[model samples]
Target: MMNRLFGKPKPETNALQTLDKLNETLEMLEKKEKVLLKKAGQEVEKAKEYTRSKNKRAAIQCLKRKRLYEQQVEQLGNFQLRIHDQMIMLEGAKATTETVDALRSGASAMKAMQKATNIDDVDKTMDEINEQTENMKQIQEALSTPIGAAAEFDEDELEAELEELEGAELEEQLLQPTTVLPSVPAGRQQARPIPKRTAEEEELAALQAEMAL
Candidate 1:
């Protein structure tokens, strides 16, 4: 009822529009101030010319007009200062309002999300995820196992076979001929006294020489 009587509280004023209006007013005031200053300067010049003509009354009148123009210029400057002050205040208020609205929106969204999500639902989801992970782990374990890996083998027989193979390798190495070293080329050989060898050493050297052949 009170709102109806008051014709509904006027919608909040648009800060941007108000700021633009202030700016226009400030510009107009500045132009007026400039014009007034020019007129004041002209008046001063006229007063000077009147004084040069020896017309004291005319010079005093011109000086009075110059003072009036100067007063108007000062008033315009004050108007511009007021407009500037209002613009600064309005811009600050706009920024503060926007910041508050943003924070409110964020808080509301968070509250709605919290309302939509239930504790029981979260727990159920976590349980399903754990079950899936366990199932996947079992599947991976099954895939990693080799085919027929479960089959048992005779450990004793396997050890005996490995021993036999080792014995055969040793016998073969013992029967293999020793590698022979190459003799010095005749052209490169230096004349030196040959070292005497023992019977076993001479036999070994003879075997190596035959192997080289």
Candidate 2:
């Protein structure tokens, strides 16, 4: 029992192999304990039979043997408990070790990535991106504008030309024909009715008289 519970493994044995060995030992110990329990029960039965036959000496001896087997069974049980404790501790240690190894690998990868990309490379890349964006914006602006939309006009010259046309229109309005009356002899200078003439009709009559002359 002691040898099984405190067994030594070779240096090359890993945690998994050790755990397997522990489990095998545990199973062997359990079987042995069960056998011992069966033997103890048989011994008790024998002691009862001897008691029925009135043999006090043989009954005491059988009881003594049963007690020894029970002790052995108890010891085997303790061994199994020790194996279980060992397995639990070993499993926990394995988990902790794996976690540490994974963290180390992740840190190493991150360090390599950081070393591969320096700040200068990052800044240069960003500058290139910005330059590309600006070039694209200029191209888009050129494509979106209509052709010949940027032709320039002189505002002052347009304003002066418009004022000249307006002044000529005002002068033409002032030159429209006016109403006229014929002269009377000095002895008959009394008031008399005169027909009203529209400005357009007066101008038409003047034009006809001039054409006649």
Top lDDT hit: 2
- In model 2, what lDDT does residue 154 have? 64
**What are the per-residue Cα lDDT tens digits for candidate 1 across 69-124?**
98998888888888888888888888898898889999999999987897888999
lDDT on C-alpha atoms for all candidate structures: 0.87, 0.90
Regions of model 1 farther than 4 Å from truth: 1-13, 128-213
Clashing pairs in 1: none
- Lowest summed lDDT across 10 adjacent residues in model 1 is found at 6-15
Q: Encode model 2's per-residue lDDT on 67-186: one tens digit a residue.
A: 999999989988898999999999998888889888999999999999889889999999999999999999999897666734355668789999999999999999998878987788
User: Where in model 2 is the C-alpha error above 4 Å?
Assistant: 1-13, 131-213
Query: Which candidate number maximizes TM-score?
Result: 2
